[model samples]
Structure formats: structure tokens, C-alpha cells
Target: MGQKTALGSLLKRIGNSNQGKVVPGWGATPVMAFVGAMLIIFLLIMLNIYNQSVLLQGFSVDWNGV
Candidate 1:
């Protein structure tokens, strides 16, 4: 019973300690900045592609009434 409670407290402390430490390499400021920039560019590209598709779709429709 005592050992079990002690083990639980040790596990809880380990979990809390993990939140304080930054991961090596990937946590560097420059790497993070580059990743952020790439993400923004990716989103912009995808948005542009979607907008182009939507714009072209309207042209493909045949309006017989017009």
C-alpha cells in the first residue's frame, strides 16, 4: 500500500517535470520560425488553389437562360 502510493506520487512528479523542459533541435527559435513561415505559405497556396477552382467552376456552368 505504501509503495503503491509512493509510485503514484513519483509518476505524477515525472509528468509535471516533462512540461518544463524544451525538446532539443526542434524547439530552437529559428527552426520554429521557418516552420511557421512554411505553414503560412502552405495555407496561402491551398487557399489560392481553392479560390481558383471555385472561380473556374462558375465558368463551366452552361446558363441556357442567359
Candidate 2:
């Protein structure tokens, strides 16, 4: 019925509108956190590889003494 459709539309509009906030954005927090965590993880992995490579090379260089 027309009344049913109108009521459903009104409910949808009310749910979708964010009543006014100081900052406007629906999904900035989780997205930013995900990106930041990924960046930190990538940097940590790179650092670990660099450290392991250096330690291996150092040991190889001193193999004759050991």
C-alpha cells in the first residue's frame, strides 16, 4: 500500500541521516586504523628482514675466526 511504502521510506531516511555532528564521516576511524596497522606491520617485516640479513652476513664474514 502507499502508506506502507511511505512509512518505510521515512524510516530509511531517518536512519541514514546523521543528525549533525561536529565532524562528518561515517567510516573514517576503522579505515584509518586498518591502514595504519598495515603500514606498521609492513615496516616491522622490512626491519626484521634487514636485521636478519645483516646478522647472517656478519657471521659469514667472521666464519674463518669461528
Candidate 3:
């Protein structure tokens, strides 16, 4: 092997077997979509808290005392 291809290079390459492979993941799940939607709601609640009752611009919710 060339000096440029050291053991560290070999180790790095070895762990990347799926680097270019199409892998089915979170985006393929309905549950993930639901969870993501809920996360957006949660984030919106927090944003309205930190930014004072406004979420996603113009979309506002009545957040009394927050």
C-alpha cells in the first residue's frame, strides 16, 4: 500500500461500508412523521415562550402567562 494509505486511513474506510448505500431510515416511518409533528408543536410552544407568543410568524396561540 502507498504511504498515503496508512493504518488510520484503513480504519476510517473500514467503518464506512454503508457510505454510499441507500438506507431505509426514520423518514420511512409513519410513527416518525407523527413524532416529528409533535416535536414541531413542542418547539412552537417553546418558541412562543422565548419569543413572546408567536410561532412560525403570524401564527399565534393564546399563551396566557408565557
Candidate 4:
């Protein structure tokens, strides 16, 4: 119940704030852009690795081996 009340107050405070304020030391836009760029890079690298694995060396399963 206490946790619920605290969460409700926090939500109400956030709702009341129309003027956006970024946390000190780091602006939101730059952090978001950096995170987005990193995500894209990671996805590209994963795709390349997957392509190499599937296209260059095919996967096969032998029932006898299993």
C-alpha cells in the first residue's frame, strides 16, 4: 500500500510537469541517439555473423549422431 501511494505520487508529479527537464550531466536527446546508433550497429553485426554462418557453413543434424 505504501509502495502504491509512492508510485501514485511520482506519477502525479510527472504528469503535472509540462516543462520538460533533462537530468543533470546528461541531456536526453544525445543519450537516446547514442543508444539508437549502438542498437543499429549491433543488429548489423549480428546479421553479418548470421549470414556468414548460414551461407558459408550450412547447418545439418544427423539423427545417428544425435
Predicted model with the maximum lDDT: 3
In candidate 2, which residue pairs get closer than 3 Å at backbone N, Cα or C atoms, i.e. clash?
none
Score candidate 2 by lDDT.
0.73
| Full-model lDDT for every candidate | 0.73, 0.73, 0.76, 0.72
Taking the tens digit of each residue's C-alpha lDDT, what string does model 4 give over 1-66? 345588888988889786676567765888899999999999987776656643544543435655
What TM-score, over all chains together, does every model reach?
0.46, 0.42, 0.38, 0.45
- Which portions of model 2 show Cα errors greater than 4 Å? 1-26, 53-66
Per-residue alpha-carbon lDDT of model 1 for 1-66, expressed as tens digits?
345688888988888887867776755788889999999999987777656643554443335746
RMSD to the hidden true structure, all candidates: 7.0, 9.8, 8.2, 7.2
Total clashes in model 4, counting residue pairs 3 or more apart in sequence or in different chains? 0
Of 3 and 4, the candidate ranking higher by lDDT: 3
Per-candidate total of colliding backbone pairs? 0, 0, 0, 0
Per-residue lDDT over 1-66 for candidate 2, one digit per residue giving the tens place of the 0 to 100 score: 345688888998999787665675665889989999999999987777656753544444334676
- List the candidates ranked by TM-score, beginning with the highest: 1, 4, 2, 3
Task: Compute the lDDT of residue 64 as modeled in candidate 3.
Answer: 72
Error of 4 at 50 (Å): 0.7
